[model samples]
Each structure stands twice: as structure tokens, then as C-alpha cells.
Target: MLKTLQTIVVAGALLFAGQCFAVDMTGKVVEVLDGDTLTFESNDGRLFRVRLKEVDAPEPGQTFGRQATQFVETLLKGKSVRVKISSVDRYDRAIAVLILPDGRVLNRELVSHGLAWHYRVHFPVDPALRALEYQAWKQNAGLWVDPSVVPPWEFRREKGARKPPPADPSAMDYNGIFDYGLIGNPDTKLFLWPDCQGYPEDSRGFAVFGSELHAQKSGFKQSPGCSRPES
Candidate 1:
């Protein structure tokens, strides 16, 4: 069953990849939702929420987020452009490549200006995009000016931190004092204390750490939703 599931996943990925290159359309920008998303209307007046392919921009609340959106608006608002449709994102936006009148690639432009990151986790890394990001990083352009710039993905995760069910009282352990081992989710790279409300009852796929420091050393960060106990 595990092998079958893997096969299904691979097939689905290939199907989506093929769909990405299967369509092209021309549209006028109707709205600028954020740095990475826009609403465009085709010649026939059908609207599509378009997300720039392979570029992850900062969320509105992040540093340079507003500047990135303004930049896009300056270049695209009320303008017509050609779109190479990729696939529909989970939010129902059309993932696409935008070609400006001057022949600039909008996705590349955002990265070149330090307004976005290459969406390497979701899409294969493009050498050009990586080079642009590095150049921007070196120059301290846009959001790069911030010393501790958090990736939009990480920002979103921390902002939307989940509140898991309270840890069961029966699960407590001690050595004269209450001892609550750290619970780490390797997938999310987040760890929670046993006393945290988000701590899990089931330990099936999680790793138990001897301490918060141990979890940190193992590349796990404390869950933002979980508060630390006084030391």
C-alpha cells in the first residue's frame, strides 16, 4: 500500500507538470492581490486569480511586502500581458508565467529585485532564479536589507501555528520535579514541550527529545504556538 501511494503521488505530479505547459492565454490585470498574486481578465472577460510560478513573495505583513506589491502594480496594473498557464494552485489561482510588453519575465523580475524567493521546495530550482536571489542578497536589496529576513513560507507557518489538543495529564513523567520531554515533528522542524497545549498525545511518528536544547541542536525550532516553561 505504501508503494502504491508513492506511485500515485508520482503520477499526480507528472500530470500536473504536463498541465502546466498545456495552456497559454492573454489577459489584462484587474487586481493586484499581493506580491505573488493578481487577478487577470481574459479577452472574453473571464477572470483568473494568477499566482506567479516559481516565485514566492513576502506576505503583506512581512518586510518589503508592500513594496513588492507596489512594484508589481506599477508594472502590471491595467496592462495586458501574455500568460503561460501552469497549473491551478490549492487556492484555485492559476500558476503562471507572465510576459510583459517589454519582454521582461515578471517572475524573474521579482527575484532580481529581491522582492521574492525562488520557490525551490515546490518547483525545481532554476539557476537563473538562484543567481538573481544571490545577487539581491549580496546587494541587500528590498527585503534583504533586513538582517533576519524570514522566508514567507516560514512566516506563514509561524503566523498560523496550530493549537493542538492539550497533552493528557496521564502522560506526565518526573524525577522529583515535573519532567516533560520535548516533542519534535521533524517534518515541520518544530518542537513542543510536554506541557504545551499543542503537545501531542499520540507519539507514532514524532521524535522525543531529552530537552528543548537537544531539539534545537537537532534542527528543530520551538513551536511559536507553544510557550516555554520558566527555567
Candidate 2:
């Protein structure tokens, strides 16, 4: 039994190690599905659908959506690129970061050109890449041209929920709002306060109050509040 347990532990450790390293694959871009998705043909002639890590592109028919697709097409279509596959997503599509023959990272380059937004949760935080994004924003490149552009992830969530509009704008509270910007769903007034004990998710109105200097301004206390109403 001891020996068997040791073998199992060793196998687990090896599997974990393998997952940490990048799986390198060279392929030709056969299709630019969108800003963040593409199909590439490997040396073995198999096509793999890849999702670019750490960048979210505009969806079809969305503002700057067409422009994002066009930009990606210009950069990669019919071109040989290298992919460092990170993992398979829920759809079985390979999540990867593409590398150009000239050594530019496609993920970072896309963000630099304002064709994509940094997916902060998944993408490695690179100061240089972020700076490039800022530069693109300043220059009004691609999607940055639209100053009111929303992130694709947030767009999807809002579209999925199909929630009703807030009833009272003036009555809306903004307290206890920690990590205000990190909340993905802009439509939902919910904020995830990381600092609060138990770190509960509170409504945006509640968070606004919790966040305010005068806690008395909002009826709610500093404690975690109720979840925001749907939509």
C-alpha cells in the first residue's frame, strides 16, 4: 500500500509539472475566426481552434468588432505562426499565445494595437504590453477610437443576463465597493469586495454605500450586503 501511494503521488506531481510548461506547436493560420479565436493547421495537417490568452476581442456586429477581425486577418492569415498552448478550454479549443516568426507575441501585439483588451485575470501582467495598450488608446487605434467601447467579456455577460435597467439612478449607492473595476459585468450593479470578511459579492448600490466615507449616507452597514437585482 505504501509503494502504491508513493507511485500515485509521483504521477500527480509529474502531471502537474507537465501542465505548467507550454506545449509548443507550429502551425499556419488557416482561418481568423475573430479577434481572439483562430484555426491553424499543424504540421500533421490537423486543424486546431485556438483562443488567444489574456486578450478579449470584440464580438461580431459589436462596436469595433469588424475592425478587430480585420486587424487580426491582416496580421496572421495565411501566415506561419507558433503557438504556445496553455490549456484546453471548455469548448475543447486550445488556449494559446501566438508568436510571429519575427518573435512578436500576437496576444500582446493585438492589445498594443487596441484591437483587443487585456484579459487581466488570465493574461500575464506585462508592464510593457500594458504601456503599449495605453499608447494605442492615446493614438485612437482600432477599437480605442470608440471611447465608450465596452469589453467583450462584459458585453457577453450583459447580453446573457438580459436584465432590466436600474430603477433609480439617484438612489444608487456606491459604498464598500472594493475591486470596483474588476467586476466583469458592468450591467449588474454587483461588486466583489475582497477586503470584507467573507468577501461577499454585494450590489453596486450597496458597494457604493459601503465604499463612501460617510457610512451613514447609505442605509446599509459596512458588512456584506444583498446581491444586486437581476438585470
Candidate 3:
């Protein structure tokens, strides 16, 4: 039993060491570029653009995009933080996990609050981050309130194929009834515009909305996947 316990302890230590980051550094956040990206200034005045590893936030044009940025700014802007650098990306940004002064993990916090997505493509194996996202979704927190919420990666890919988004998306007719009408999911309490990628062809059990306001009045929220074009 003693020998078995010793072996288990040794294995655990090695596993932890394997998960350790390549570099650890302390810095103050100078600027919040977005939800998951920030400018970090070292004590000696050196600057590095740091990206939160395994986290992706909504784009500036997407729904809740500004909120995610505001969330990070509220928590870390101008505050000192410790970062564990895992690797440097091609864009010259350090992929890291930012640790707040109060010991909260910034990456995990973002996902837990539904302000960011767990970047599974880049760092796919973090079960904690995955579970946090699921919990946020289950609770309908932040962006999760939009039942058809688009992942940042998917949003980016879709955006790349289209013309530039308008300067003021709010000016678009969200409540206006278009020719194709709206697709709604009664179970999720979300309504998607006809052009939305998540709109289903089989609308058997789904509810229909005449306009955005009609859906809202009926206790349904608009999905981020439904980016209404300018009327």
C-alpha cells in the first residue's frame, strides 16, 4: 500500500508539471483591445499584446460584443495581473491565462459568465472551461440568453464572406417584418430571422414571429445568428 501511494503521488506531480505553462510574467493591463485580448505592460515598461488562451469573445459588430469588452475592462483594465504564457501566436501575441490580483482566472471567468466561448479549436482539452460554458448556457447568462448564439469563430468565418458590416447596426430594421418572416424556437424562447444560419427548413413545432417586437413581447429574444440586413 505504501509503495502504491508513492507511485500515485509521483504520477500526480508529473502530470501537474506537464500542464505547467512555458513562461510566467507579471504586468499591468494597459488597454483592453476586446474581451479576450489586452495590452500588457511589464514593470520595466515593456509591452506585450496578450490573448487569453482557450477563450474567444464576440466580435465588435456581434450582439453582446461591447458587453464582453466592458466586462473585461471592468475587471482588469489598468489592474496588475499575472500571466502564464503557453505559446506565442503568429500574430505576435502571447497566448496566456491571465490571473487577477484576487486569484481569479480571467479566461475561465469570461466563459463562466457567458461573455466568451471556450476556444476548442486551439485548446480543446480543458474540461473546466467547457463545463463553465455549459453552465453559463444552462443558466441563460449574458450572451447565452440568445438561444441561437453564434460562436465567435463561426461569426468570423461568416463575416469574412460578406461585405463590411454597417457602421451603425442599430439603424437596421430589427423589428420590421421582412418578406420571409421569422423562425422561432418555442423551447429556447428565441426567434431567428429568415436569413439566419440556424433557421430551420422544418418549422413544424417552432413558433412564428411577425416581427422582432412581436417576438420580444411574447418573451422571446433575438438570436445573434440572425443579423438583419439593412432594409
Best by lDDT: 3
For residues 1-231, could you state the per-residue lDDT of candidate 2 as single tens digits?
465335434433443456644678797887777889987667766566778986888888577788888888888867788988777665656778899988999898888888887665422356666577768777888876654455576577566332243464333322222213332223343333343334435535323322333333433333346332221
Instruction: Choose 2 or 3, whichever is better by lDDT.
Output: 3
Q: Candidate 1 versus the native: TM-score?
A: 0.63
Worst 10 residues of 3 by lDDT: 171-180
Q: In angstroms, how far off is 89's CA in candidate 2?
A: 1.9
lDDT of each: 0.72, 0.62, 0.73
lDDT of 1 by residue, 8-47 (tens): 3453355366675556778788778899998766776556
Number of backbone clashes in candidate 1: 1
lDDT of 3 by residue, 1-231 (tens): 465335434433443456644778897887788999887766755566778998899988888899999999999866788988886665657788999999999999999998998775432248899789879877878887765455676567568243344465444342242323466798999887656777787887887654577678899888875765443
Evaluation by lDDT, superior candidate among 1 and 2: 1
lDDT (C-alpha) at residue 97 in model 1: 90
RMSD of each: 14.2, 10.5, 15.4
Q: Give me candidate 3's TM-score against the actual structure.
A: 0.60
